[model samples]
Target: MKKYYLRAAFIIAVGLFISGCAGKSDLSLNIINGEKLEENQLLTTKNSIYLVNGGDGMKTTYLSVVYGEEIAEGSGLAAVNIANEQLCAYTAPVVLEKLVITEKEALENAKLNQSDYVIYSRVEKWTDPLGINCTVGYYTDEASVVLSLYSTKDEKLLNTTRLSKSSCPFKINNIPVSTGSAEILYEELFANWKNNMFAKVSK
Candidate 1:
């Protein structure tokens, strides 16, 4: 009965685009679409999962609801250090959470469905829509992640994959990406990023 990881930290990094631009998508949607990719792999007993550098979404999936949404891009690591104090109680099979964390923690925890897993996400890109003119800048970012699940019982691989994405949306008609209103757009991109990754896994 030692400390467990129930909390997470979020980091959103932003920097100017050098000059190499890439094509972006135009469609916008809510609840970003996700399609489970073909994972055909099973589980093994020699490995353990680690959710590193990415946001808190992964932690929310397996940890308690109290720590739900506790970590994400730019989250404080100190908060995780503190929450670990109560983490031991959650390590039991009866306390294992869900495949993915929602807004609420299930009143009665259940045994682990799978073996141990790891989630790692990193935001490598952020920028304004407009340039130096102040009328055409926008905020955009790229996130990359890897999820690993090791089975102490199986000694194989289960539900594992490596995912990486650099998401950004520029004004098609020169409308200029707005930083003040970027939250909505940023959320949209993040949602898409998350959905796509999950889609690949679910399949």
Candidate 2:
């Protein structure tokens, strides 16, 4: 009877832990930084048939979040927004997308197959995940994520920043925090990439 009671209690505790980690994390977005902007911009597309091509007369560059299989939820677009809003402001309301991969991969590959950019930056870290528990009393290890920009143009890498390891037990805190941190890192990384190698090949 005592053993059974202990097992049941442990199971309940585990259940609660799991719920705390993922139950509240409904969406991975809300981190893409372009929410507050003053001047919109023109569409950056070189050749296009889409009517949303230019001059919305707003400051918010309408950027769509890129959902990817290997995506870190809201990480990619969030970062991109941060960069867009800060770098060289425009009045044309540019359209941006968070991309795990762009559709113009073939063109990129053909042009910048030898680009030398490989900038990496760590945005956040947490570990032991929340799935495992031990006698160590909520002991979690250090896990980290890095934001990288591969310049498909000049092959130049920049701003390999590593953020501090976020002390989180699970997704409850880590997901949001990591998502925000990663965005900031990517924004910085891409901004520099623009100055160095971006938009050189695929424009």
Candidate 3:
């Protein structure tokens, strides 16, 4: 009888753990559009980069009352920071302060800066953690962004990556502490793309 009781408890615990984890994490990344980088094409030392914010506006939805455009702007800033952190190891990347909504604007900006390449990052969606719905149950925080790399010489797009991440917070002393953000997703996306580049070409 004692052995059976212990086994049942173990099964229950495992079930709860799996359910909790499944409910807490939701992440996706897709190449969606654009061609792949050619070997030894964009990784050359002579290629200078312009990192631009391509987000036009923030879609707050449920978070509109509590959070605002600042959240979306923060996401863009996070992307630029991550790109700079990763690309700087190879070459110094120029950070552009202007927000661009189209590829033409981004390419023009890059040309103005005399940059050979362009990194256009746009924040598409944002659902902040502290919304009215969060008070009732575990609220999922979601962020989505599109990253595109381009060649300024011919205004050709090299690659475009779209990624999204959503995670629910585990409580700490009755307070929900979120473990995910736009910054985290951007870091993962850029790091993976950079590694793939290094693998394909000598730089």
Candidate 4:
């Protein structure tokens, strides 16, 4: 549950760009915490799924504070897109397009969809080094999110996992690159979370 505060003076213009042969990312994800039911929570092959927007659309604190709501919403939508793409492995999840601020509403939507389970996510921390010196750009971005799984059958919480990524490094020709937003780090976080959730549910 770490909070990232952006300095008002760090806000910079949007014209900065770096050019280079993009190298493999140096991003590594960490599991901040996770919880699960004592009973096995494995999923069957062809299960109905729903994803409730857990207020990530307008709740990105540092992004909104630094780059305005438009940038924040874009980053938040990137998160949703990641979830949608990755969840297609099982089935194209029924995703709630609008932000749902309350868990009750989220669960109700899942129930209405007749989903076997529902996934909910909240962005916890985000850091964008827009003004940080580009010379030292190895692992400058960071993002964190908490994902919870609920069984719509009984409307009971089944599992929760918090994943974080702060080690994403953009490089070209082996040179580090710094961007104005934390989108890269956020992608890494969501990708890792997807893998983790699949592992847990398949167990």
lDDT of each: 0.30, 0.33, 0.65, 0.57
Candidates 3 and 4 compared: the better one by TM-score is 3
Candidate 2 vs candidate 3, TM-score winner:
3
**Residue 130 of model 1, lDDT score:** 30
The global Cα lDDT (0 to 1) of model 1 is 0.30
Error of 3 at 71 (Å): 8.0
Q: Which runs in model 2 stand beyond 4 Å of their true positions? A: 1-72, 90-95, 102-145, 149-152, 156-159, 163-203
Residue 170 lDDT in candidate 3: 57
Worst 10 residues of 4 by lDDT: 8-17
Ranking by TM-score: 3, 4, 1, 2
What TM-score would each prediction reach against the true structure?
0.29, 0.27, 0.67, 0.61
Weakest lDDT window of 10 consecutive positions for candidate 2: 49-58
Question: Model 3 compared with the native: what TM-score?
Answer: 0.67
How well does candidate 4 match the true structure in TM-score terms?
0.61
Q: Report the number of backbone clashes for model 2.
A: 17
Clash counts per candidate, in order, are 37, 17, 0, 0
Native-referenced Cα lDDT, model 4: 0.57
> Pairing residues by index, what is the TM-score of model 2?
0.27
